[model samples]
Target chain A: MATEAQGESGGGLEFHPMDQFIVSPLFGDGGVAWYTITNATLWMALAVAAVFALLVMGTAQRQIIPTRMQSVAELAYGFIYKMVEDICGKDGVKYFPYIMTLFMFIVFSNFLGLLPMAFTPTSHIAVTAVMAFAVFIAVTVLGFVKNGAGFLGLFWVSSAPLPLRPVLALIEVISYFVRPVSHSIRLAGNMMAGHAVIKVFAGFAAIAAIAPLSVVAITAMYGLEVLVSFIQAYVFTILTCVYLKDALHPHH
Target chain B: MATDTHSSAGDGVAAASAPGMPQLDFSTFGNQIFWLVLALIAIYLVLSRMALPRIGAVLAERQGTITNDIAKAEDLNKRAKEAEAAYEQALADARTEAQRIIAETKVGIKQDLDAAIAKADAEIAAKSADAEKAIAEIRAGAMDAVRDVATDTVGEIVTAMGGKADPADLAAAVQARMKG
Candidate 1:
């Protein structure tokens, strides 16, 4: 489908490091109107659908004994509960639902992308940047709402010497701006690296038919990528929590 | 080289814009993201408004049940202690009444035995005194009768036998025989 999209090119385009990062057209132009969905979009949709189905099923019965589905629902609820409580303190409970959705969506998206022929929307810089930007906007808005313009004091630590205040404030502002960049890049980099390594090792399977040694290396890499997927999701969620903490109580 | 590069670029552009080809980043993804966010908002609303309230209600119900159980247990404990105290009081009262009855019965029996014993002792003394008096009277009357009989016999014998006998000596002899 991509070949069809790039119609004339059989294999002429040069591959760059950035090529691994960008999301190109998944299917070439086939006049299907707006009906054509890309693989990334599909996986993303599936993640959303899965989340809905799980939540709906989990809560539909509301049993006292708790069926497996209900338990799964409760587990998710409990996990997010702890996450919010630990990060935002008792007050964090109010935001539990939102944070739970965020964690599940990112985790499911990352895991889904590990499958064969699946596109990781999160692997795209645009997608991650947008998520990061949303978080940034939310945290920023929350800060102002909670602290009013006094939130500006978050950047200027009065504890610093009077002479160093301006410089420290500048640094703080720069760091604050860098939050979204780092947040987005962290997720994007981890996802792209994992997918690239997996693709490279998988490519070796074609050659491993001739060179048996490549099989062992491919197996090890596949195992490593699997571990990496879970770790990336954890890292993403934890960093999100830490960022939210800074927003909730900005100081050091 | 310029011509080759230009013609290939032209070909690439032509391929990219071919009929029935949709443009990349044509807001398709943007629309999807928008819908996804909207759906997310809807889910969040439902959870917060419906599901969350129900969960909270269940938890509150559980807490209420626990509280009621504790309260009931405490009430039962209080009742049990009261009953135990009442039972002990009843037991003590019964013990006191039994002791009183036993002592009263012992005293009553002792009184009846002492009264009967005193009455029998008095009767035996009275009968012994009367027998002594009666015996004395009998002795006196017998003595008198015996004297008369002796006198008459002595007189008759003296006359027949031609021997003299004195009245005083005969009486003395009779009396002496009686004394022996």
Candidate 2:
């Protein structure tokens, strides 16, 4: 800590982008237990509260001619509902609640993380990986439960030549396994990268001569981060729908 | 400003040795993942139980309302169109009735005028026939009176000449002169 302060005093640029991402205890400083109520818990609870505020309390009145908040809620419902129905078909609509949960949480986390001095839960590999693995495991189980032995058809490319089918199937199986990794990493990486870039640019603002340009870069990156936040949530939800589609109709 | 912000923000977790990437710090994975699962579960429960159904119902109700309103509007439009059609029908009926009445009146007037002309023609023909009969009778009477005068003059001439003439012969001579 003294060295960081010393580094700052020496007129060197300070970059603590990961400090914002650290999952430390909200109260006393110690090892983070599994049950510890850390900043991650606060922010996660905030995400839950946000979801509840918007989805539950915001639409409590349930007016036919909606208020602005209710309209936003309805828009979100329609958007995710249509995605599930479109990608996974009508049968997939049953899972709309689950997909919607993931979307709302991730989206809220990303946006809330954009707030100054806020921790991004989605930026952590552990959090996103848990979600991605949950989806992967659930979809796999659902596929096998629904299709039995036919669930393996997801790997077997019937359209390819009989000789090439084996090679294609190998690649397909590997990619199938990689879905969770890519899914989790894609979100976490985008969040981490954008935020880290913003922090780096913010660090550059310590230079008096380039402060204006750094501020401009941060502003631009912030705008792009806002877009990425929503888009990542959308992509995650859509991919979940796609995976669910594969589970429901594994033959295709 | 940047140093102040970085130091203050960093002071929260500066107690722990700062990892290059906090995301890879497996020590905190349990905490983040556990909270994330809790949040996800909480959100899922909230959405599935209360929020989703309410929003779904509201959307459906709104759709129903919009559909009902549109249907009502369409019904009103249909009714309006029917009313206009009925109005046009009534107007046509009135025009047809008026034309029929005018045609009927014209027929009646033409019939009455024809009957009056026929009656006048018949009355004038009867009057002329009666007048011709009277004139014919007067003309016959005038011829008879002339013949009679001729006969009397023949008789007087015979008497003044002192000739013993037969009455029949005189009469025959008068008749012949008159015939000529």
Candidate 3:
């Protein structure tokens, strides 16, 4: 379809795959302002609304025998709840709500982005970075607040020899700070790569000879992206739980 | 084809002239981050206040209902067991009462049988004694009558065959012959 549009305009098949990631003003063609309701804003709001519909309105009745939406909502709730408890222990379950919100937002954004013309906010490093930074900052603050100066004990390797302890501590500190970068990049890279690859395949479909092969490749990629989308969300959430565990128990 | 190439060239120039990469374009980062934080805060509030509590309540309520139902079932089972025990006790009592009645009946029947047998024996003994007394009286009377007849016959024979003799002497001879 894209190639046909280009052909109609007397253009040869030229596809700019990265153009899809552009964040433009939803209302006007002007540059995005801080208050401008961009496509990212709309999709992010939609994700929140989706979570509300499933978790709040869907479970409004709280039926003993749950409806399909309620079942989904409860399943999500239990899934995140169990993850938090298992990873962070009972004490850390107090923060289950925040973790649940993060999971729902990311997963919903990913699944919604799979729509033909939809925007995936999670594919942008800016969005994932903010979430990762928030987790990093919050856990670090909580670690100190809860454990006092002993929070540094997280970096100290008691098992190592006394001479090697300082080196191990430096390594641990660097890796600890690197968590947010890796965490953000993992999600954004997976989502961005899958979408770009699909677009490239779609562009290849312009050729009559390879059109069928392009379609098959797109189909396969789409399936993999579906799995990737959910898995990435789960990975991000579980990692958050792990960080929270570290904050709660710095001794380990 | 000419128009397609023209538009394609223009798109390529526009793409090149545009910012390096939209992701790297920091001009909009401020806007995106602001909205993202706003959106995330809104989501967190809604989940914490409205959605999560509702879900938690539902789960807690379901758990409570299950436990209550189980407790009620246990109570009913206990009552059923009690009722069964009572039924068994009543059955045992009835069996005992029936056995007592059977035993009493057997003893009463035996006592009545023994009393009847004793009364019949006494009546039979009294009747047999009266029969024996009557037979003895009849035998004594017949013996006395036969003796008197024999004495008269002997006196007549002596008077017909003898010469003149004293009545006393004849009588004596008869007596002596009879004796001999």
Candidate 4:
């Protein structure tokens, strides 16, 4: 849909890099309501299906000696499990399933989005914002519940001198509130930026003189995006663990 | 060309008002969020309910299997060591028993030899004593027979020479001669 821009009209070179992110209805040229199945839904569904195929059906045998898919499933399990345990400590292991869910969803969505003409759900601020806010809210509530009034100690800056504690506390509070915003934006920004750059480069291929350079740029950007996709997912998961750690033990 | 440019310029303004960045379009946020929440929930359910527990069990089972195999191997090794010790003890016991028997047999043979040697020595001493007594008796008998022969020879000579008055006188002469 985006590449079909002004092909018949022999006008100036047209470039609509951001057009790929449009959330149009899959069935028709209609409006996108909250429950409507758009390209976003299709990709999200694909990501879910991919998760099921990898983790669920792949480990159906539950063998001591694992198959390739089973091994990968186990690796993903172990990687996230270790991450949760390390950042959040052993006590934080209870929340491992939630962290794994976020990691697998983002990672899969990212990798799947690498396919040609595919929509990246994680690239959207709305999607990333919701997940980040969910994590933030959950961690905050857990901190309060687990530690009671002591959870506010996260912002109290007990390590500082008593005179400096108030200022430090204010700064900590601001930073604490900003965590979800930064967390969501970081992922969404990285994914969106890489994809947009690649699209911009792809648009330049309309010129016969610089087609090779554009292709090369696209290739490099595509490779970087692949790395970015996984890393962004990883950063998101690790940050969640960090937040969870703070909730579990907010003193330090 | 002028008409085309004007039309394109109007389209650009329209596009700008609608916004080129789809991410900034607030109208679609609800839709994206709704689908994302649904996807996350689906992923969460599938993972927590089915996949994770199975993977965990398989990992746990593999660990347990390894531990059990190692334990079994160690147990067998201990049993083997015990068997070797038992065999060595049996061998040592047999050797001791044989040594004791040999010592007893040697002692018995020595005792029997001493007894035989003592009995033969005593018999030899007794025979030597009896032979010495018989030799003294034979010497005495020889002396008596010599005296009788001398006396008879003197009597016959005296009778022949007609110088003897009686046999008693001749006996007396022989006895005197034997005594000198």
Candidate 5:
């Protein structure tokens, strides 16, 4: 009975036993254990490479009216321009290029994960965590440089009365610290959950008698996931704008 | 799950390919992160320098086209107004010329009537002087003829009477008769 239970526990197929990347501690056959690379890292590099190649090729053939490559380039620029204008106002025009690149990187990374055999970099907490931390650091530093020590007053929120100052400051400080954690987790969690669900459903459908229905469900979910992926990218970029706005104008 | 099958396969790969393969870690991802940042910077530079300007030029070109269209419309309207003014001026000149011709004709008719009246008055005065001269001439001739006739009649009467007396006797007789 024990053997049977053990056999059953280890039976059938389980997709993705490890995280997106499985790191090994050694370099070759026999060596001291050092470090390993994750698949998420691989996908991230792929996304970056793909983006670089696309930009290089897109600009190579510069048609006056615009070819397919030029159109793609124009679409990227125009989309980011509208986003900055809407979220950060006219003053945000200066940051248009940065925000546009960030949006495209996230979008491409998220879409790459949706493929059959591709890894999703966004599903990993560390990747999103680092990116979020960078944003936090940048905005915080900018606020200080722009407003001096008065930037600290952002927590106290000068509008608070003397009696309520300490309590409000404590809450504000907590929320400020929570920013990076939430920002990173929101993207990581959504991506991880979506991919996990798709894998599980695919596994169930693979062995089921009515597999066709499950395929349909999977197909529908994929379409929905694509939409969510775009929305997530847009949300991330807009939030970045909002945070930068706070840095630029510390009152809010 | 499926570890039993994977264990044999894993053992095969782990043993045949590489012996005693160590586990992986998060630090291996560091290099990747570095390259990613570098690539991101490169992409950013390309976008800022190349892509953005093209987009700006397209927008600027669109704006310029609109402004040019507006300027053209304004110019056309100005020209139309000038043409309208010119047409009105020409019409006014034509009317003024027609009025002047009518006025000149009226003055010409009045001048003709005044000249004819002066000519008729001179003609009537000349005809009246000629009639008066003819009347005076006839009156003188009639007087002379009547005196001559009377003298001849008296001579004839004296000769018929066979009077051989001198002219002095005749003159004395006439004077005595007149005094009586």
Candidate 6:
């Protein structure tokens, strides 16, 4: 067995599963500078292209009875449109284009990452944090700009006892600040964990004794990851809607 | 041999010295954020300007067409209902007219029959009266002739036997015998 041969040789079975997520330069062996195109850039560009093809080219005909691709594009549009409307009310619907763009990019990136040897830009904190921070800054600024000092009322707990109000307010402020952290981590963590688990299973497939089990585990994890991919995208978008709602109506 | 060692050492450095998680690396955040914003802006433009308007137009057109078709169908249905009622009313009117004509014809026929019956009755009465008059006249004439013949015969017999009879007496005797 290869395991036995590796044992006889000094080197052990060295399968670096996290190596798949390395942000190396795409062109040559050069280190990734700030501007050097990398795997993340390529996949991000592909995600953008996929979104364009689905939303723009797919619906170019604008048939009364939509074709299959058009149906998919319309379904995605209506899905996010309804989500924003339902969560943030009519006022939040104006920002639907931004939310829709965010959802399409994340979902397409997640889906493309499932392809063989594909990089998932969404799995990186660098990518997800940018989106999360953007949402955080936008909602915070909107809250202050729209509500002025009344935005601080979002932290005030009127229902609590007068003695506990300050403590509860503190907790609310902490949680409010934690929103971006949790938002960014939730998507990136779920994606990174699922992909890492699959890579680990694939590593086990080299052993003859447990190769079949490893394949089954990979299949199951892949199925779960597919669900996670869509769900994480949905969760990220809905949370953005929730924050937008808070910004729009920060009374409670 | 030196190149091989260097490559192996580089792999070793990457595996051992690198951060445990690549996500914690903040160096590439600028690039990812820059590109993400660009891509997202492009998507937003495509959606807002191109895709959403087209889809909205199609949906609105379909709704308009459906509502218009429904209204047209409803109008046609109302007209059909009015036509049906008008047909029923005309049918009833024709039936009543037919009944009135039949009744009038029957009354006219009855009046004509009554007049004809009266005329026949009058003509029968007139003809019977005429016949009775003629019979009466013939009877009287016959009676007179018989009396005359009796007188002549008697006178002739008398003459033959040299005896003359009275004509007034013969006539009165014959009339009295006929009466008895």
- For all candidates, the clash counts are 2, 0, 3, 0, 8, 0
TM-score of 1: 0.60
Top DockQ: which candidate number? 2
- Interface RMSD, model 5, angstroms: 7.1
* 1 versus 2: better TM-score goes to: 2
Model 2's i-RMS, to one decimal, reads 2.8
Per-residue CA lDDT of model 2 for B20-64, tens digit only, reads 677777778888878888899999999999999999999999999
lDDT of 4 at B10: 44
Give interface RMSD for all predictions. 8.2, 2.8, 4.4, 4.7, 7.1, 4.7
Candidates 4 and 6 compared: the better one by DockQ is 4
- Candidate 5 residue pairs in backbone clash: A21-A38, A21-A39, A23-B24, A24-B23, A24-B24, A25-A34, A25-B22, A25-B23
Candidate 2 lDDT: 0.88
Identify the CAPRI category of the predicted complex in candidate 2: acceptable
lDDT tens per residue, model 3, B1-180: 334334334444433444434676676688889988988898899999999999999999999999999999999999999999999999999999999999999999989988988888888888788777777777767655654554555556656676455656755666566578
Writing each residue's lDDT as its tens digit, candidate 5 over A111-230 gives 988987676767666567767888899889988998898887878867778899899989998998898888878887777777766755675575667478869878988888898888
Classify candidate 5 by CAPRI docking class: incorrect
Error of 5 at A161 (Å): 4.7
Q: Write the per-residue lDDT of candidate 6 for residues A1-252, one digit (tens) a residue.
A: 233234336443334456566666677766557677878888988988898899889988888788999889888988998999999999898989889989998999999999867889999998898899999999999999999999999999888889998999999999999999999999999999999889878877878898999999999999999999999999999999999999999877
lDDT of candidate 1 over B47-136, digit per residue (tens): 666655555565466568789999999999999999999999999999999999999998998888888778877887788778777877
Per-residue lDDT of A157-205 in model 4, one digit per residue for the tens? 8788999999999999999999999999999999888888898787689
The window of 10 residues in a row where model 4 chain A has the poorest summed lDDT is A1-10
Evaluated against the true chain A, what TM-score does chain A of model 2 have?
A: 0.95
Tell me, by TM-score, which candidate is best.
2
- For model 2, the DockQ equals 0.46
Q: Which digits, one per residue and each the tens of the lDDT, describe model 2 over residues A140-195?
A: 99999999999999999888889999999999999999999999999999999999
Query: What is residue A220's positional error in candidate 4, in angstroms?
Result: 2.6
- In order, what DockQ does each candidate have? 0.06, 0.46, 0.30, 0.35, 0.11, 0.27
